[model samples]
Target: MDDAQPITTLSGQIVQMGHLDGSLIERMRHEALTAPAPWKAEYGEFQSGGWWTTSLMNASGDAADVRIADGSARPTTLLQHMPATAGLLACLGLNYMWVRLARLEANAFLWEHRDYDELEQAERHRLHIPLQTNTSAFLVTGGTKVHMDGGRIWRLTPTYAHGVCNLLGPDRIHLIADVYTDDAYARLTKHAQEPTVDERLPTASEADLSEHLATARRLADLGYTAAAEQLLLRLFYSFAMPEGTAYDLIAGLHTALGDAEASKRWTAAKSTLLALAS
Candidate 1:
């Protein structure tokens, strides 16, 4: 990836998948847990057992409604996720969609499902909005996992078959939101702005890298050796290909093709890559 390039998808969507600074998350946690409001469970219309609270919420909007197990109130949008609720409403210029605060413990997992149905053809042409952006569970703290921090944020599209397992002893708390965008911020403020509807998509420059790799695999799978060879050559020049053991396997494949020219290119590219490594 070019360091100067703003990593984005071919469509110019910004991808913001990362962990918040520890100090920031801690601050948010303190603000949420220490708030004056007593935690109250609210109900939801669509979900069977969904409920939420405002004890920790300091956001502008009203708290979410929840349908607790005790059948307290039918459903009320009273409780809310403090940091996420406030952050989404305040920064992104967003409105609409359900936001939830969830608690899950060890061996817990959410069944995979998409947020909203894919945009209709007509809607596709209209201005897009950030409809689904959810932070990870806050209560569940530890695991032998990729992102275990309570403050870790993952930009996910449930349409893509995502699931989570909580192997830790403590329960996990999540502040998930359904969002839609109303305005666009300038490039300078992009980083400071709320996550966008298309924020999960890879940036334009990174998409080039992704596309090239996908094409190479597809061609190889179809037994189109010659076509794959041609694409691989292009990728060699375009990307800083992976090095070491993977290099030997790639070079051996080219050599097996008996195309001395292709083999030479791969070898040369590998040499350049190794020199840079050194």
Candidate 2:
């Protein structure tokens, strides 16, 4: 098996997945929207409210084990309920490791962050099939914004810091599949095209950083610690900072607030969160 390469080394963060059946996608979206299964909220530390997920295929068939890794991909009851979706996956013939439905409600935001950092080093990739989405729901990566339209599969290299948001929406849902690198994937992506840069984020000036830092301080002084932390975290999406800069800013925020313990904790978290160990 090949060792997993750092996400930063990937050639491109977004790739096109070719065309898919629109009617089938509609059915999958309808099933997901109507399903009664509980939608698990994302970790409080990572995102704001309104983001939810439910596993379709995962290691051990457990919905709670959302981690990315090499494991026996087993379908959950949720997959059984969406026979059309199962058929679609079967037709693709990709070696799925984890598959899930991700829902982001209106005004939801997934703070800028990286994924697969905690997983064992292996060749894998995350693929997204937009089911029900709107213009407002888009992904920001490499300082560019991309609205993954339906009717095609989109690939996201999550090892790089990226953020997603549904700024205004009824609700956005996507069928996400984590697949191991294999011949099928290689062939499927043989014609993969680079994503067009929809919008480029401007570089943050020193003055801009200073203003943000000062605002964070005010928010912290007002007793909105979470808000303060998030205000700093959003900077990651706006500017190309060195890895772990956001966490460092949060740590500094705590230190200035005289919370030495919190400062130490966030500093430690920066290391643990960004560590890429095999």
Which predicted model would earn the best lDDT?
Answer: 2
Per-model tally of clashing residue pairs: 30, 0
Compose the digit string of candidate 2's lDDT tens values, residues 103-150. 999988887667887677889999999999999888877667788889
Give the per-residue lDDT digits (tens) of candidate 1, residues 156-268: 33222222434443544445443334343232134432234321222334566556646765776688865664454433222332222223434556565555776576566
Question: Clashing pairs in model 2?
Answer: none
| Candidate 2: clashing residue pairs, number | 0
Worst ten in a row by lDDT for model 1:
137-146
What TM-score do all the candidates reach, one by one? 0.36, 0.88
Per-residue lDDT, model 2, residue 193, is: 85
lDDT of each structure? 0.36, 0.79
